[model samples]
Target: MAAAVTASMQPKSMTRAKKWDEVVENAYRFQLAGYRDEEEYRSVKKVDSAEKWDNGFVKKLQRKDGCFYYYNKARECSDKDVPKTKLYNY
Candidate 1:
């Protein structure tokens, strides 16, 4: 199970996000909740998808320890965080 999860979550390549977008926003949220990205989050939580707002922004995320983090509809990924957020390719 662990091997399969790891394999499925492995990224073919990764690059620092150059701008803020929906993808980068999700990466920030996932990292905050202690997952690499949405794929790993789903694998660990066994969920089909993360909760999202109507605008397509993440609405909530559950951490590894089972705590839930809620997000507002506003943009959470700031310009300063753009360089730190990683964009992964499968």
Candidate 2:
């Protein structure tokens, strides 16, 4: 019985230690098209959160269509002519 309790508590402790990553990934995925499908969003959220550690924070991109995209600003395209890039070039 004590072993069962210890095993259950271990998972919860691990989850608490990694909650931040889950939040960031969820927000990121939502910004991306990954959340477009209701069912897929739910599943993706779970898997993504598990893979990302608490230190992993996803950056969001401001899209031209008034929506957000999931991308790291450092790696994003800087060309102004890029239609899918951010509306504001500078």
Candidate 3:
């Protein structure tokens, strides 16, 4: 009998840091500041990963609400005070 392939055997694509940055930027139009809360950063990171896996890398940060935002490259926030905002509105 032939061996069956499992879901885990499927090949997965790895996302690059640059692509992730683009996705995050598109979702939120602001400088990341590179100083986000651990939870918040992880949430955004998941979004980026999903986006990369599904739609490939793009220069935009897409929110769950389907909103797109842009980010600045030169400007950034300091670790002491990274901007914080609600993920979504109820």
Clashing pairs in 1: none
As a whole number from 0 to 100, the lDDT of residue 86 in candidate 3 is 15
Candidate 3 lDDT, 7-29, residue by residue in tens: 44333442212222333433233
Q: Could you tell me which 10 consecutive residues in candidate 3 have the lowest summed lDDT?
A: 81-90
Each candidate: how many clashes?
Answer: 0, 0, 6
Model 2 clash number: 0
Clashing pairs in 2: none
Error of 1 at 29 (Å): 1.0
lDDT of 2 at 60: 49
Tens-digit lDDT track for model 1 on 1-90?
355486656899999999888989989988878888889888988899999999988899998788999998998988999899988899
lDDT scores for all predictions? 0.87, 0.33, 0.32
Candidates 2 and 3 compared by TM-score, better number: 3
The 10 consecutive residues of candidate 2 with the worst lDDT sum are 81-90
Which residue pairs come into collision in candidate 3?
A: 26-60, 26-61, 26-69, 27-61, 27-62, 29-70
Mark the regions of model 2 whose C-alpha exceeds 4 Å error after superposition.
1-26, 36-50, 53-90
1 or 2, greater by TM-score: 1
How big is the positional error of residue 50 in model 3, measured in Å on the Cα after superposition?
A: 9.0
Estimated TM-score for each candidate: 0.91, 0.21, 0.26
Model 2, TM vs. native: 0.21
